[model samples]
Target chain A: MENVATGEAQRAAELPMDNDAFAGFYERSARPLRAYLARVSGDAALADDLMQESYVRFLCAARSWDGEVAGRRYLFRIATNLLKDHWRRARSPSIEEIPEELFATSPDAARIESQFLLGPALAAMRPRDRQLLWLAYAEGYSHREIADVTGLASASIRLLLFRARRKIARLLREPEAEGRQGRAR
Target chain B: MIPKSCPRQSEVAAQVLRGQWPAGCVEDLRQHVNGCRACGELVLVMLAFQSARAQAVSGPAPVSAGVLWWRAQLRRRNAAVERIARPILGAQIFALVVTIAIAAILLVAQARNVPRWFSWLTQPGQSPGLHFEDLWSSALAMPVWGLMLLVFGLAAVAVLGGFVLFSDRPRQ
Candidate 1:
């Protein structure tokens, strides 16, 4: 009986840091997660809040984390769900308010500024289109990676990216980028 | 679907951005983009987006010197959530509760002098020094039969309660 108790205690000792593991894991994944969230929401504050919530969720789920599953991929998967939830909770605007200074920043400015034009272009897109563009372009995800991230078929990634690019290009060409919707025809 | 009016190379640029470059198309796109300034510029923006994002700070914002203390508080909050959730969700707790209930009912029936299967087993006729009242009353009374019955009862309760608590029932 004593031996069995000791063995169980030893096994528990080797398991992932029950609560202590969250700090290190959060530190490791936070930066990329923030950037990913920032681009998706186009609002830094909202991204920050989502980042905190995502990590809290990560910590809660960590009790179930098997060390073999790549932690980063799972975390991103969680973040993707949270992002979808965030979007769903938001009411759709009759007209998207496009910012005029999209892409107006110098190339070396903050990525947010560098992608300002892309931001509204992203905002102008349907949520799925925005997700496809961000997952591919900003997250450095391959077609397969985007497919995993968004649960879309891998074979369709190229076609979807193509469609996303056309939409962005059409948006960029609008004479009044903010007020008028792009006319692809 | 690719817009029919888009330059052939722009489609290639999207593929390249996705790291899915087709060898045949890359060269053709390169030559066309070299000749066309608009396609060339779009390619630059796309490439820049990728590069800049790669360098972006992803996680939490900057924290002050007392982040360790703040983290401790967050840990407490998380632990509290787990503590609350565990009792509601823990299989063992539910099993323990059920076991205690069953044990109490058995002990009560014994107290009431009711003819219980347990009392019948522990009755003096079948086994010496095994009457529940005497075995429990006497000092150093091992009450082997009662002890064994108690252990077996607890084990059965644990197993049965576990199945009830953990097994999923199909919705009607």
Candidate 2:
């Protein structure tokens, strides 16, 4: 146990020495990153696991970035790759099997209806579409930032976001159309 | 989808979604969208989708960063220890296999020679050249079971040494 502690101390020393800086960074970024992971992968547990792994990997990485913006972009890129790798290694859940929290019930009728429409609407899209749309729309990431984070071409983001928006809008309206059809019947 | 006539429709919609239009370009973007039905619909849908997505992913994180950092450190330490112990484990298994093989061969050889040696000993008139004292000083000093037990004891000691060397528990 003493030897292990010594070795761990040695490794910790070798890591980035600014714990306060890293703690600040984690505080600023962890929540949004967790939310991004949960929304993209549709699993809260997986999101938490991936978020920790992403931070660990970020700390271990050797490259340098200019500022917090660049650092954040790089961290997100690492996280995106990790998510892709995970899906490759395991059998991903179908859209219907996405976590229930995404479509949680609410007392307010409008909020409940929006949640109902939004959860499955987002799920029905491709993972890449969901990632691109969420980052662009929900997170307010600019085209270049999304490109940096997602490894997509900056020129392609506009068209892709457009299509993703269209698809989600169409999906959101599908339930209402179904209800109208039921009323007619 | 953008109309064939509006090549900049996607770009305008993307800029609007990101709130990245230049200060002077805002009115141009607005006028362009107001004049183009496709661009107008695209803007409205983008805004609505952004709102829904925000609501979908909003919540508190499951675990805090400090806890995650601690867990990551533990995992890394465990991995390092495993890396150091893997070769020791391989060597232990190799030594055990070799020891068992040698013991098996010795047992088979002794079993085959024991009856012949006993017959030779029973014939008192025949001089076998080998003296009792010499035989007693050599392999015959102990019974087969005793020799086997000694070999097993040595093997056990080697295995125990290996276990101490390659134990999963961290050394103090």
> How much of the true A–B contact set does each candidate keep?
0.21, 0.23
Q: lDDT tens digits, residues A150-177, model 2? A: 8889988888877777666666657455
lDDT of 2 at B85: 54
Model 1 chain B poorest 10 in a row by lDDT: B59-68
TM-score per model over all chains = 0.51, 0.59
lDDT of 1 by residue, A1-185 (tens): 23443344344333244445655666556777777776666667677777676665555453567562357666677777887777556553311243323313223334545335555555556556666776665555677877787777999787877777666666655625534534432
Candidate 2 stretches greater than 4 Å from native = A1-18, A38-128, A139-160, A169-185, B1-26, B45-62, B108-172
In model 1, the Cα lDDT at residue A60 comes to 44
DockQ of each: 0.14, 0.20
Q: Write the per-residue lDDT of candidate 1 for residues B93-160, one digit (tens) a residue.
A: 66667677768766864574445335546664874236666555653454466666677777978686
